[model samples]
Target: MRAVILPGKKEVQVVDRPKPVPGDGQVLVRMRASAICRSDMSLYYGGKPLVGGEAAKTGTIIPGHEPAGDVVEIGPGVRGLQPGDRVAVYLAIGCGHCTYCLSGYLSLCSQWKCVGFDVDGGDADYMVVPAQNCLKLPDPMSYETGALLLDNMGTQYHAQKTLGVSGNDTLAIFGLGPMGSAGVLIAKARGARVIAVDVLDSRLEMAKELGADVVINSTKEDAVEVLRELTHGEGVDKAIDSSGNPAAQNAALDSVRKMGSVALIGETSATTINPSEQMIRKLLKVYGIWIHPIWMFEEIANFVIDHNIPVDRYITHRFNIEQAAEAFRLFDERVTDKAVFVWD
Candidate 1:
């Protein structure tokens, strides 16, 4: 197998590697499509708590998590899934017995381990993951779109769940990145009036197509004031921060109404953010969102399949597995919203 490994800061290379055999309760999936995520860049550039730190150090890591593929082989003790099944693999393999998993918040499980981040991911010809973490793809969905259903879209769904946004609420998403764009679609689907914010005009235009009622170019306008005026002096009912930037986080806090919820879904490495003023003045419900639970992936996939969510619109670029380095470069430049590495 050929895999791209990020050995150290700003280092990535493709090399031949041995194929992995699935252990008990695991399934070996022949890679089909895997999408690069913002968090992947963080790890590649030395983010804290690197999931696959050891593998990365040894120069053998394969970084990818938003993977969709077909099961090529099943290991001992695996059941209910078999070879040839098309599946969207869940990256976070949480310990099932943990208190967090038992309470249905598996993303918060203390012993959670992730693929692409914690182990060798799907950026190669094949990858191994636990059978329990795989979600069967609908027959009609393309593998490229299916790969995103579990990870990217699922994150948006979870953020909405946290903020309790509904048909009657007005929401503002402070980023037009892929996940935030998905939130706009979901929010509109649920009948909320969505305001999307981004510095990029192209992304703001994309957000409008995805159903955002208004798009703010934050580089030119005060996003908070814009939201306040749009909401008639009361801020939006909910605001979501998906830019993973401190400024965006602050904008989200400043754009929501008193007592309104703010959900942070993007991965941020910023050590300090002074939210005390906003927290005290607004009595806000601030949630730090992580990756979503597996069950949400099923529900989100159903929504996408049933309602035909325009998830494919987020894919601005596609590359073969050999183009992994270029994919990461584009991601680094923020020139593309989402890029997928195609294998089959």
Candidate 2:
């Protein structure tokens, strides 16, 4: 079996490895589709993965957290799923006895481990995961779409729901990366008027095609001013920042109307904000959004199917395991908006 391993900086390797077998309560899935994400860049660059404590520090685990495939074998204690089941493996594995895990908030559990970062992942031809971590993928869904459901698409879906985005609201999204692009699709599906902001013309163009009501070029134009003007000078009703860039984050905060809500989905370090001005003065409601709880996968998938949201629109490149080097290179260089590794 071929597997992708990032041993260190600027290196991508597809090495031959033994195919894994399922252990108790686990299932071995034959990998079908996996998506490359911006977060994977940390591992691609030889830096430690964002999760997985000591395992991530070793820097040898397969580097894909967004994966979906077909079940081939099930170990003892596995139930309700069998061979031929099409599923997307939720990335986090938590101590099942914990309250957070019991509530389906696996990522919130104290003893959570990430699949691709902490153990072998779907970057290989076969990988084993706890049966409980597998989310069923509907027959109508593509493997690529299934892979994205846990991360990019699901994150935006959770964020918008948190802010209660609806037809009555005007939403502004900063950053047009895949996450931001997903936000546009979800916001539009909810009937919100969407204003997308980005520095790149390519991304802003793609955002428009994905149903963004208005697109603002932050590099060439003033995104805040454009957002205000589009909302008839009242500012948008809600804002989301997916860039994690400080300037874009601040602009998202400033572009929304007083009392308007904002969701910060992107990960960033310390970003200075005036408490009195950005929070108190505006009476803003701000949410820090990470990947969603495991239970939300069903709702997100149904929403995707119900609204006919085109998840494939976010993908711009596809590769095989053998092309691991070039795949990460293009993604790292920002030449591809969203890239997937597809199996035969």
Candidate 3:
């Protein structure tokens, strides 16, 4: 198998590696489509930190997490799954017995392992994952659409869940990237009034096509002021920050009304908050979401299957496994909304 191995920062090569066999309770998936996430780009560009908070250290990591594939084989003791099943892989591998896992908060677990980050990932021909992490893909969906469920789509679902969106609230997302674009559709499907915010005119137009009630270009207009006026001085009911920029976070806080919730699901190295002084003063709820629980995968899978939201809209580029470096470069340039690796 040929896998892109990152031995260090700015060092990635498509090298021959042994194919992995599934262990107990695991499944070997022949990847059909795996998208390049921002985290993967960070690791490739030497911007992502090591998992243990170690700085300036990189390892032989194969980075990719958003994956959709066919089950090629099942490990021993794995039940309820068989070869030839189409599935989406959950990125987080948590100890099922941990307190965080028991409470459906796998991201907070002490031993939480994320595929493509802490563990081996789907950047190769075949990747092994826990059978429990597999969610059945709908019959008619393409592998590319199924691929988004793992991270990008799941992030939107988590944001909605975290904010307690009741389908009646108006939602605004900052940053019209893949996650933010998908969020428009998800929020609309939940019956919320959706607004998309970005500096990109094309993305804002795409968001409008995806059912956003309004679009705001923060570059040309004051986004916080516009939304406040649109809501008649009350501000939006929910605001999501996907830009991962400190300014976006502050803008989200400012754009949401009293008692409104703000969800952060994008990549952030470090961000400073004023000890919730503003949040307390405004009676706001701010949540920083990194990973969603595995169960949300199944739920989101159903949503995608039912609504058939245009997941393909996010794909502006596609590459093979060997073109990993170019993928990272193009993604960093922001020349495209989303990029994916399609296996032969």
Instruction: Judging by TM-score against the true structure, name the best candidate.
Output: 2
Clashing pairs in 3: none
The CA lDDT at 123 in model 1 is 90
Against the hidden true structure, what lDDT does model 1 obtain?
0.83
Give stretches of model 3 more than 4 Å off.
47-57, 272-277
Best by lDDT: 2
Give per-residue CA lDDT, model 2, range 1-344, as digits (tens).
99999876878888998888789999999999999988888788876566677877676788788999999999999999999999999998999999999998888988898888888888889899999999999989999999999899999999999999999999999989999999999999999999999888999999999999888888889888888888889899999999999998899888889999999988887798876888789999999998799999999999999999999987999999999999999998888888999998
Q: Candidate 1, residues 237-302: lDDT per residue as tens digits?
A: 999988888899988888888898899887666736556778777798999887777777777878
TM-score of 1: 0.93
lDDT of 2 at 11: 87
Clashes by residue pair, model 2: none
* Worst ten in a row by lDDT for model 2: 46-55
Mind giving the per-residue lDDT tens digits that candidate 3 earns over 1-344?
87876665666788888899999999999989999877766577565443523322355666778888899999999999999999888877788898888876666878777778777788888899999888888888888888887788888888887787767798889999888987887887788998889999988987887788999999999999999999999999999998898878888988899988999877677877764664988899888887777767768878877876777877889999988878877887778788999976
Q: Estimate each model's TM-score.
A: 0.93, 0.98, 0.92
